[model samples]
Target: MGKITTHVLDTMAGKPAAGVRVRLFRGAELLNETVTNSDGRCDSPLIENPSAGCYEIVFSIGEFYHIHGTESPFLGEVPIRFSVEVGQHYHVPLLCTPWSYSTYRGS
Candidate 1:
């Protein structure tokens, strides 16, 4: 079965980015949204049986940093755009700081 999941780790705190709001979208269409758990993972898979198309992950970075009491200029949203092939499991993990972030295909 095709599936997609993600994790977020706060490098500044050396822990998971718990309680961070995450929104998934397929182009202009909103698919689903949820908050990350203590392990920085969504409680459920973000997508399953996803068609071959473009998907974007919106992470509420500014708010997350605020909650963590990190100094920030509120640089706006963090969005990661990726494409999924048919019938595959996609794991995207984000390692973020208050000012910047990075993501890649994860196991």
Candidate 2:
């Protein structure tokens, strides 16, 4: 079976984005929700039974920056839409700031 994982980095802060809320969704169906640990990594894999389909991950960008003492962050929830294939391990890492964010497939 394939798997999916994620991590967040606070580019502005030059560190991992801890305590950020992350949610995974397959189509309109909610799959899982998790918070980033101190290292900005989810405690567990987001998708343990990954398959070929479109998926979305929502990152609470505004809230994360707000909690870190940044007021009026330009970005809110940042959603990354992607597709997974069978037997693939997808590591979708988010590099984010209050105003911008980016994601890419990892090993």
Candidate 3:
């Protein structure tokens, strides 16, 4: 089975990105949506597909911090774009800071 999963860490804060809103989309159309758990993980796998396709996940960083009452300059939004291959498991992880973030293909 082809599936997708993700984990998010706030490098600057040195913890998981809890309560971050995650929006998944296949091109312009959304496929699923989820929020980060306490451990900074989604309750379900990010995606389950058979073959490679364009995908995007948007993270609501600004709102998360604002609601929690933190002085943040994260710009409030981040998006990660990637593709998955058939018969393979893809792990997409986000390492973020208040002002910047980074990501790469994961296992």
lDDT of each: 0.89, 0.93, 0.83
Off by over 4 Å in 2: none
Q: Looking at candidate 3, what is the lDDT of residue 45? A: 88
Give each model a TM-score. 0.94, 0.97, 0.89
In the range 7-106, model 2's lDDT, one tens digit per residue, is 9999998999999999999999999999999999999999897878999999999999998888899999999999888988999999999999988999
TM for candidate 2 is 0.97
Q: How many clashing pairs does model 3 include?
A: 1
RMSD of each: 1.2, 0.8, 1.5
Candidates, ranked, lDDT: 2, 1, 3
Best by lDDT: 2
Candidate 3: clashing pairs of residues = 62-76
Model 3, range 1-107, lDDT digits (tens) per residue?
88888888988779998988898888898888899999999999877763678788888887877776768665588888887778788888888877788888787
* lDDT score for candidate 2 against the true structure: 0.93
Scored against the true structure, residue 88 in model 1 reaches a CA lDDT of 93
The clash count for each model shown is 0, 0, 1
lDDT by residue for model 1 over 1-107, one digit each (tens)? 88889999988788998988999999999899999999999999998889998999999988888876866735457899999999999998989888778889988
